[model samples]
Target: MLGVVQTADGLPIHHEVFAGNVAETTTLIPTLTKILKRYPIERVVVVADRGLLSLDNLESLQKMTVGNRPLEFILAVPARRYGEFDTLLEEHHAQHCVGATHEVVGELVWQGQRLIVAHDPEAAATQSESRDKRIEALEQDAERWAGKLVEQETGRSYRGRKLSDAGVTARFYKAVTDAHLGHILKVALNSKDFEYDLDEKALKRARMIDGKLLLVTNMPDYSPEEIVSRYKSLADIERGFRVLKSEIEIDPMFHRLPNRIRAYAMICFLALVLYRVLRMRLKAKNSPYSPNRMLEVVRRIQHHQVTLHRKQSAKGLTTLTPEQKDLFDTVNLPKPSKIAL
Candidate 1:
């Protein structure tokens, strides 16, 4: 697994390479240990998404000491598992923000820990609409399966591989799982028919907290808004990851040994570093070009070579466009030269 740490402005601080099978939650502590030993950061609060939050990881962060004090953290709560926070959220919302149309921020005690909830009415509407659509589609699929099974029982026949009960159960459950409705819908499979049980309570709870984002923080000094904002900044690091995957294409490895993989990861990490730095520079300059666009502009300035007498070569460079020149200046790089240095 490749984990990268970045600053608030999204420039990469460092990256860690681990065995690909390592659990994401388990990597945070080790990665932070290395970063503390290397960087000169005096105060630190780890802001991570829900995927990296585990009870063990949270406990480790709570016990970890930076210098003379315990580590601070703001982590996202997996609110989709609404059983853990449904009542707390209802109480918090009822007592604090009722009928809030925009974002409503509130806090409550969850098993003696501070649970920060941010409710976006707009997001709630979107989530509810999306879930309703998916559930509707799932119900239609279930009906279609029921019709097919009935046809089979009624002595109707067709081509293509017959749909077995096993296959239908697998397919229906997969569709339900892909839609993230497993908690609300249970596949009731029998040898003869495909049916499902809907957990009304789970469905109600999901709708109750559709757009609610739960965050937990141990930083006593930080406010709820601060915790939420810091956690949102993690999106920048996620963007960096997408850049590594799509633009850099770092996968499809042929290496069998660990050390070679590490070297390749380091090289890709350096390239990611450069890409982020360029992005920062371009943003600061208010340039209209993205890093990818800047690269495209740079690529446009091709070089031409001509062989002269005495086997000497003369080179010529295409004239730089105005946008291309501004891109070069923004990136703090010299223009390409026709003459060999």
Candidate 2:
């Protein structure tokens, strides 16, 4: 397994390989240890999604320190999972409501821990719309599945898995769970077909916290807005990973030796560093082409060479297009020459 760590500015800082048996969540400790040992930054804040932090991990992190100072962290919390927060959330919404699409709705002390809650109306709307669409499609699927019962009554059958009551229940539940609406969707299995119901109360509860983001943090000096901003920097980290997987093709390794695998990973990491540097350079110059796109354009330019029987060989680069020349100028890179060295 491979792990990568990056900064808020979309720059990769560290990477490591792990045994296949190592759970992804367990890699955090070693990765952070290596990072802290190598960089020795005085103030370090680990910001991550809810999936990364267990209760034990949080406790361990709270105890971890650097240079005699405690390490800080901003972690997302599943607010809805904590029913105790419902009353507090209602109060928070009532007292700190704002008209903006997104805002820090409230900052409350829960279990003596600082919890900053934010709301995003746009995100909420998108989520609500998605759920509604999925539910609608699910209803349509139910109707079709029920129609099979009618066919069964008339002695008609299809050439796939035979439709059974148990199969219908299992299949429909799988779909519900896949859509994450298991709480809101209800199903009844019968000998004929299947019946399902939408739990209005459960759905209302789900919709209430659609875009509500709750963050738990140990950084006392930072404000709610600042905490939210740090958590949002996760986007840049994700972008770094995306660039590695898509552009560098870091996976599907064909190597047999461990050292060669590490070498490949190191090369990929270096390539990522160079890629980001080129990206920054292009952005600084306001170039229209991305580094990947720029490479595509430049690769089109070719060098031609011809030699006479007894004379020195002649070599020249193909003519550079206006776009290619402008790109080179924008990036301050010297264009290749046809002159033989």
Would you list the clashing residue pairs of candidate 1? Answer: none
Displacement of the residue 20 alpha carbon in candidate 2, Å:
2.2
On residues 1-341, what C-alpha lDDT tens digit does candidate 2 reach at each position? 77878766677788887778988678887778888899958888998887876688888888888788898988898766777777777766656543555554568887677999888878878898999999999888878887886697699988887787677777898899898888888876553547789999878767767788988888999888888988998977777778878988887799988899988999999999888878888999887789899999999999888787998788878889998898888888898766653
For model 1, the superposed segments whose C-alpha errors exceed 4 Å read 94-98, 144-174, 190-195, 308-312
Please estimate how well model 1 matches the true structure, expressed as its whole-model Cα lDDT. 0.82
TM-score of each: 0.87, 0.84
Model 1: per-residue Cα lDDT over 1-341, one tens digit each: 88888877888878878887888877788888998999887888888888867677777888888888788888888876536677677667676555778898777777567888888888888988999999999999888887887798788876887776778888999999998899888997664556688899888777778778888887788788877888888888889999989888888777889889888888988999899889988888888889888887788888889887888887788888888877788878897766672
Angstrom error at residue 103, model 1 = 1.4
